[model samples]
Target: MRGKRDIERELIHAEAKIESLQTLLESAQTDRQELKSQVTKLQDALVAARAPEAYRDQQIAKEEENRTPRDQAQIDKNRLIQKTTEGYMHALERPMDVDDLDALLARSSMHDIKGPPSLHGNDES
Candidate 1:
């Protein structure tokens, strides 16, 4: 009789453990669903923030379709003007004139004046 009572007690303990585990599994499943819903809401918000609206997209398409050769010619003209401006800027940056060249060379190696610079071919002596 004592053995039978011990077996009955163990059986009750095992059933209680199974019930606790089932309750824990249900809670975990509920938490997983809530997390999935939160993730979906966050993804939708991110998409709306990053994507352009349909009206802006249509305006860009219409503008592209309406562009003419005149617009292309204007773009070419602006490019030419920019190239010419860069050339002018480069030219201005260098010593082009003879006096400018003389001044540049003189400044580069300039020292305390000892005597006049030697003139090789232009000497009258």
Candidate 2:
């Protein structure tokens, strides 16, 4: 008879726990719905903020006016060409010696220095 009463008490405790869990589940669902509503409202606000104004055309026109100088510079360059006489400017130059070349390379921070030629893969010329 004592064992039967203990089991009855444990059954009541389990039922109380299940009721508490059910209440928590309902509260969580309500919170989820509120968060979803807030997210929708924020998305709508972002869409409105991103919409172009009525003066957008005028703004674009002003920007195009400001870009005239860059456009003119491009057009000026397109009409210009190098003269053929410029070709002989370096025709008589000779390769520099190691010391002079090294000095120039040091001045340039060695940014343009190339790797040494490979000797291991020269089966042909």
Candidate 3:
């Protein structure tokens, strides 16, 4: 009976030791994976550093390719705005006939006349 108990005790201890080793093994595997990822990142950085001008040109080309559409859109927007603004300015600069002014004034309640004077003058009115 004593020998049987001793054997069982040794078996329990062996199992506990195996479990601890397995935990350590899992930890080591996780550490190894993290180290491998870090090494890969470091290798990429080293390669970029070795050929910096090539890397810079590649990055610049990529940026310009991305920016082309945005630049074109901005240019189109500016041209449209400028065209609309010029149309408004040209309309403001044109001389209005007194009859047209009288018709415009009749439709609205504004009594003040601050715009450019009629080309035909008050004699035409």
Scored by lDDT, the top model is 3
lDDT for each residue of candidate 3 in 4-122, tens digit (9 for 90 to 100): 99999999999999999999999999999999999987876886799986776566556656774666777677556655554445556877667655555544433354444554364
Kindly report which residue stretches of model 3 are placed more than 4 angstroms away from their true locations once superposed. 53-125
Q: Ranking under TM-score, best-scoring first? A: 3, 2, 1
Reference-based TM-score of each model: 0.40, 0.40, 0.43
Report the CA-based lDDT of candidate 1 relative to the real structure.
0.64
Candidate 3 positional error at 54, Å: 4.9
Off by over 4 Å in 2: 52-125
Each candidate: what lDDT? 0.64, 0.59, 0.69
- TM value for model 1: 0.40
Candidate 3 weakest ten by summed lDDT? 107-116
Q: Predicted candidate 1: what Cα RMSD to the true structure?
A: 21.1
**For residues 10-80, what per-residue lDDT tens digits would candidate 2 score against the true structure?**
99999999999999999999999999999987865665577654245445555756765566666454333
Q: Report the CA-based lDDT of candidate 2 relative to the real structure.
A: 0.59
The sequence of per-residue lDDT tens digits that candidate 1 reaches over residues 1-125 is 99999999999999999999999999999999999999987865665577745445555556756876467777677556655555556657975774554444454323233333342223434
Candidate 3: the clashing residue pairs are: none
Our tally of clashes for model 2 stands at: 0
